[model samples]
Target: MTSSPEPTYTWGTTSEINSFIRHLNKSHRILALCGAGLSAPSGIPTFKGSGSYWKNHKAAALSHPETFEANPGLVWSYFAERRRLALCAEPNKAPRALAQVARKRKGFVCLTQNVDGLSQRAGHPKERLFELHGSLMDIKCSNKECDYIDKENFAEPICPALAGDPEQPSSFSFSAKRTFTTQRRDATLSTKPSRTNAHEEYKYKREPNPLEALLESLSPTITPEMRQVVIPESELPHCPKCDSLLRPGVVWFGEALSKPMFDEINAWIEKEKKLDLMLVIGTMAEVYPAARFVHLAKEKGARVAIINLDAEHTGGIGLGKNDWMFGGDVEEVLEVLFEGVLLNG
Candidate 1:
């Protein structure tokens, strides 16, 4: 069978975006693919490029399956802090706009790489939304034999010990270049160190990576006293059904997405012949499998549009004749698209 001729795409200004959205409202089979940048306006940290760190550790170091296996307590502490923050974050205008449009449009699907439930919080229907990476709010048993999975667990750590506690005088420095203060697990003391502190306090010219420092502290050269900072296994979350440990339900580095989710995405592709509009929002399209979807959508004759901060979107390799690229703050660009449109009327 012959495929349709490729449509011509225009590089658009905010006004042009608004005009496109006006036309989009009358169209069917819209798909929005979202990433961590979608929630950045709500003060959530993204895991792309430099300057994106969580608890002074590179997010990649903390979000690996091997890291979890090596130090479950550390992994638990990290995710617990993430969940605590996510619970307080409200859905921003961008996702809410998508949700409102989905309500008025038919054959709308939202696929998000973010584990945060912001889209759902904004009233996107669960049936139409697929969180490609599993949600942080979901917890599953770590036991290979157990098939236990719990949704919306909202689990928090109970007085989990910190390896950087000041009183213990561990080998690692807690603060970047300031007097280290101890933070209690009960919300006492400040969590973030002052960024403007003078650099003289550091023991070395460059600060050590927190995860590497952690490993060094754990080595046999360290005295027995420093080991006390580690959290005991019992302090972490455990599976209720089998008494095994529980881990975050997110798809970690070096791990495959759940088979059911992979199958579901495949099924979605088959069901929609004309995925006329494909919105790749907030993600850099750097990861595998998920990154391939852009090519797949284009091959299926979908008009691909990318909205991200990365320079690659402006113009680079593999860009087709019918591919729109918008480089800007996702929320701001989306506001331009939805303003006086679905958001207002």
Candidate 2:
């Protein structure tokens, strides 16, 4: 397909962007593919790059199946912290503007790799979005037989061992300091918190002074039960029928992308035939499947615009002369773009 003539705009000036907005408004269908960078202005952390917080840990630790299998309690704690962070963050102007645009237009779809759920909070229609990474607010049992899932506040007492133990209560003491190390149970299968380190390991031993103070600070009000304790995976909730521990339902590294989600996104792209424009904001565009969406849109002859603090040497394959590549802080650039062009147009 032939590319459309590049529209002229004074990038930093409102008039330039208003021209683009006029073009956008004329299109019948538009789709947005967002990444972690889109949420960074709202204070969510990016997964990879120089300033990322996950530098010490592998990406899989937060979303990998093996990590969950080895220590469901530890995994849940990680997500609980993320949930807390996300809840405190407010969606910035970009998502809000996109939502406004989406509401006014027909056939708009947003596919986001972020689990923060900010898009929904920003008033984007639920049916128009596909949260490909899964949501941090969702919890489910690891036991396949149980099929138990619930929408509980992540800040609530979350421990695998405490699942069925009414006598056992939830506490936040372990949420930040909790750590898990792998130990082989046997040749075939392994259990987390293996007998080797199950509460008796030298490292697991609480220091006499600080540990006591920590325990004291954990007021019983933090949990429903009066007792303040951190349950190891050994004490996590077990499947009532099969006696298996429950775990959070996050998509981790090395795991296949959720089949149902992939299918849904693919179906949307197929039905659209061609996207009018693609706004790639604040992402490095390195990851698979999610990054592949940009290629698909370009293949179908969509105009692509990239906005990021970092630069891509290739300018993304298939981006034409008409497409714009604006490099710098996304929020600042977007403020300029929207105020200059979109809002006025």
- Which candidate ranks first by TM-score, i.e. highest? 1
Model 1, span 1-345: residue lDDT tens? 999853211223434465467656655777788886688677565543333344445556667766666677767766766676577689988898888877776577888988888998899988888888889889888887998988876645433442233353322123311211111111121222222221121121221222343243232232233223345788776888998988888887666777887688768877867667778887766555777666666666677777754423322226566556665556666766656547544
lDDT of 2 by residue, 1-345 (tens): 999854322122234355565666566677677776578667665534222223133333335565565555555555665666677789988777767666766577888878888888888888887777777766666765687766534554455333333364322233221211110111112233342332222121121221232233233112222122334666665555556675555555555667888888788878856778777776655566678888887877778777654433323345577776654455556666555234643
Whole-model lDDT, model 2: 0.57
TM-score of 2: 0.67
Residue 276 accuracy (lDDT) in model 1: 75
Structural similarity to truth (TM-score) of each candidate: 0.73, 0.67
Best by lDDT: 1
TM-score of 1: 0.73
lDDT of 2 at 320: 73
Candidates in order have lDDT scores of 0.62, 0.57
